[model samples]
Structure formats: structure tokens, C-alpha cells
Target: MMVKQYLNDLVSLFFPQTCAGCDVPLAYGEQLICTACWFHLPYTYAHLDSENASARQFWGRVKLEAAASYLYFKEASRVQQIIYHFKYKSRPELGLILGERYGELLKESPPFNRADVIVPVPLHPAKLRKRGYNQSALFAEGLCRAMQIPVAALCLARVKATRSQTQVNRYARHENMLEAFEIRDPEIIGGKHVLLADDVLTTGATIEACASVLLDAGAAKVSAVTIAKAL
Candidate 1:
């Protein structure tokens, strides 16, 4: 262990590790994100309350037990850069690290603490193949580590590919997401409280669709958490 640490330190000396959020050199004890950036990032304290804005967003749309996001996402901000890298730059570990940290916080919150399983919003097979990984599932894996809950990645699946939700209005987003997801094995989630996870929450059309399918497949209840929420 001592030898490995020494070699890692030597490597870092030659190629300094940089913070994912700010691109600054990380101090010795810091991991992916530096302490300053971590503290200054816009955290949404929504997990502490069941009636937060995130949960309210799903009020009339879906039967959600709870919902919350860890951070507030803004365009061209540090959170956005981190998420951009997490999804597009093959930095899946960033999702895991953020999810684990957020999961620890969620474990202290209500309905979220009662989750029996973690299920990530699935990517279409083609997209998954192209990306070489499911960013949401990586986040779920880290959440499971901290919450000590099981993850059911294959229980739900994206049945169809949809166009980018970014270029569309709310109605178009909802229409595009229709029938995009399906439950592959209802038995795994039946009678269980599922916590659906994703990288970000935007117009929330995708999450609403996933939660609807989970409920229809016999899930007792559905909650949701994301790394960030778009304003």
C-alpha cells in the first residue's frame, strides 16, 4: 500500500491531477473536485424536504413519492462543465463520485431513505453502445454503495430512441418521450419502493415517463434523484 501510494504521488507530480469542476490542480487530499469548488457549487437542499420544487414538479404529472436534485444547474457553469464531461468525455467516475456523495445526504432524508431499490433511467441500446456506458447506471452504482440498497439496472429499459429534448418545447419533449421506456422484469420491482435516478432533471418529461412505467409495472411507489436540476 505504501509503495502504491508513493507511485501514485509520483505520477501526480509529473501529471498533476486537475479538478473536474474548475480545472484547477487538486490538492493532495482532494479527489475529482477541489474543496473550494465543491463548497461554492450551487447545491439545492431539496433532499431535506419532501415538498421541494423538484418534487412539486411531478405533482400533477406523475405519482411520485419524492423527488430532489443535489445541485442547481446553470448554463456554462462549473456544474454544467462537470456534467458535460461526465456524459461526453468518458468520465463516468464523476457520476459515481457525485452520486455517492448525494446518496449519503439522501439517506438522511425521508421518502428517499425508504427506497428499496435504485433504478437508473436507461439509455437506448444504440446510444448505450455509442457511449460505451450508461452514465445514469454509474451514478446508481455509487448511490447503492452509500445507501446500501440494491440496484436494478436491467429492470427497466429504453424501448425507443428519441430526439434531443434540448431543441424541443415542453409538449414536444413529452411527445418524444412517449413509450420510450418499458419495464423488462416487473417481478424485480413489484411491491418495492424504487428510487429512479438520472444525471439531470430538465423539463422532467423523461423522469415522468419512467416513473409512470414503474408504477404501471407494480412498483409500490417511485421517488427520484438527480445529480443536478436545470433552472
Candidate 2:
């Protein structure tokens, strides 16, 4: 064991791992993010209140039981950079790490703790193939690790490939997302309080569509969580 540790330390010295959030070289015992960047992250604390901005975004549009986001996303901010890397730069593990951290906090929150199963917003088949992974599913995987709850990735699926919601108005977003998702296996979600997770929350039309399908499939309740909120 000592020899193995010595070899690992020698390897790390030549190729030091860096923090995902800040690109700073990580010391021993540090994981994806360094201590300093983790401390400086703009945590939203939205789970503490059901009426927080994240939850309110779904009000009257979708009947969400609760909602929360782990961080606040700002243009050119570190959170944005982290998410960009997580989504487009092949750093899916960062999504998992963030999700696990968020899940640890959600475990203490009453509304989120009521979740029976976690579901990730699905990617269209073509997009999933191109990306090689679904970012939201990776995030949900981490949440499962921390929460000890099962993730039902096959329960919900995106049946249609819509244009990006970026630069779109609310009305356009709603139109583009209409009937975009479908319940692939209603049995898994039936009578369960489902926690639908995504990478971020903007106008929330995508989540609304996902929640509608889950509710129609007989899910007892649906709540949403995201890595960040772009407000």
C-alpha cells in the first residue's frame, strides 16, 4: 500500500490534477473543485423556501411541488464557465460532483427529501448520440449517489428534437417545447413523487413540459432541481 501511494504521488507530481471550477492545481485530498472555489460558488439556497425564485418560475405554468437550484449563473462568471465545461467540454464528472454536493444539501430540506425517485430531463436520441452523454443524467447520477435514491432515466424521454431555447422569448420557448417529452415507462413514475433534474433553469419551458408528462403518467407529484439558475 505504501509503494502504491508513493507511485501515485510521483505520478501526480508530474501531471497535477486541476480544479474544474477554477483550473487551479489541486492538492492532495481535493477532488474536482478546490476548497477556495467551492467556498466562493454562488449558492442560491433556493431549496430552503418553496417560494423562492426558482419555484416561482414554474408557478401557474406547471404545478411543481418544490424547486431549487445549487448556484446562480451569471454571464462570464465562474459558475457559467464551470457549467460550460460540464456541458460542452466533456467534463461530465463535474456534473456528477455538483449533483452529489447539491443532493447532500437537499437531503436536509423537507420538500426535496420527499422525492421518491430522481429523473433527469432526457436528451433527444440524436443529441445524446452526438454528445456521448446526457449532462442532466450525469448530474442525476451524482444525486443518486448522495441521496441513496434510485434514478429512473428511462421513465421520461425526449421524443422530439427542438431548437435551442437560447435567445428565444417565453412564448417561443413554450411553443418549441410543446409535446417535446414523453413518458417511456409510466410504471416507474406512477404514484411516486418525482424529482426532475436539469442542468439549468431559464424560462423553464422545458421542465414544464417534462413535469406535465410525468404528472399525466400518474406521478403523485413533481418537483424540479437544477445545477444553476440563469436569472
Candidate 3:
């Protein structure tokens, strides 16, 4: 064991892990994010407020039981940079880390504590094959780790491959996602309050699209949470 620890330490000394938020070399016992950077992250505390901006996004459009985000994302900010890494840089573990941390907080919040299961937004089969992993599913896995709840990973399906959301306005994004999602297994969501998981809350069109189908499938209610929110 001592020899193994020595070899691992030698390897880490040459290629150290760094914090995702600030790109600083992490210290012992630190994970993806360093303690200081984690403490300084722009947390939204959306879990504490029902009428928060993220929840308010679906006010007149969708009947979400609740919606919340963990961090505030702004262009060129640390949150945005980290999120870019999370989605595009093959750092899917970041999703799990953030989700687990958020789940710890969600356990204390009324709206989310009632959520019986977590259902991550799905990726179309082609995209899932290309990406090799779904960021939202990884996030849900992490949340399940911390929340001690089940993740119904195959409960929903993204049937249509819509245009890149970044290329469209909010209305167009919603239209693009309409009928794009379907419940793969209604029994998984039936009569259960679902906590919908995603990497970020942008225009919220995708969440709106996914939540509608889950509710129609007999989910008691749907609540949404994400790693960050674009304001």
C-alpha cells in the first residue's frame, strides 16, 4: 500500500489535477474544484426561493412545480468557462460533481425534497452515440449519489434531433423542441414527482418541452434543476 501511494503521488506531482472554476492546481483531498473556488462560486440559492428567476421562466408557459439553478452563468465568466468544459471538453465528471453538491442542498429544500425520482433530459440516440455520454444523465447520476434517490435514466427519450439551440431565439428553440421529447417508459414516471435534471437553464425551452411530457405521462409533478442559469 505504501509503495502504491508513493507511485500515485509521483504521478500526480507531474500531472496535477486542477480546479475547474479557476484552473488552479488542486490540493490533497480536493476534487474537481478547490475549496476556495467552491466557496466563491456565484451560487444562486434558487433552492430557497420558489419565485426565483429560473422558476419564473415557466410561469405562464409550463406548469412546473418548481425550478431552480445552482450558479449564475454570464459570458466569459468562470461559470461559463466551467460549463463549456463540462459540456464540450469531455469533462462529464464536472456534471456529477456539481449535481452531487446541488443535491445536498436540494435535500433541505421543500420543493425538491419531495421529488421522488430524478429524470435527466435525454439526448437523441445519434447525439448520444457521438458524444459518448449525456451530460445531463451524468449529472443525474451524481445527484442520485448525494440525494440517495433513483435516476430513471431511460424514462425519457429525445426523438427528434433539433437544430442547435444556440443558433435560435427563445421562441424558435421552443418550437424546435416541441414534440422532440417523449416518455420512453410511462411506468417509471407514473404517479411520481420528478426532479428534472440538466446541465444549464438557458432559454428553458428544453426543460419546458421535457416537463410537459412527463406530466402528461402521470408524473405527480415536475420540478427542474440545473448546474447554472443564463440570466
What overall lDDT goes with each candidate model? 0.92, 0.91, 0.90
lDDT of 1 by residue, 1-231 (tens): 999999999999999988889999999899889999999999999998778889999988899999999999999899998999899988989989998999899888888989999999999999999999999999999999999999999999998998778888877777678679889999999999999999999888989999989998999999999999999
lDDT of 3 by residue, 61-158 (tens): 88999999999998877888788888888899999888888989998888798889999999999989988899999999988998888999999999
- TM per candidate: 0.94, 0.93, 0.94
Q: What is the C-alpha RMSD of each candidate to the true structure, in Å?
A: 1.7, 1.7, 1.7
Q: How many clashes does each candidate structure show, in the order listed?
A: 0, 0, 0
The digit string of per-residue lDDT tens for model 2 on 10-129 reads 999999988877888998999878899999999999999878999988888989999999999999888988998888988888989999999999988978888999999999999999
| RMSD in angstroms between candidate 1 and the native structure over all alpha carbons | 1.7
lDDT of 1: 0.92
- Compared with the true structure, model 1 gives a TM-score of 0.94
Stretches of candidate 2 off by over 4 Å are 1-4, 166-172
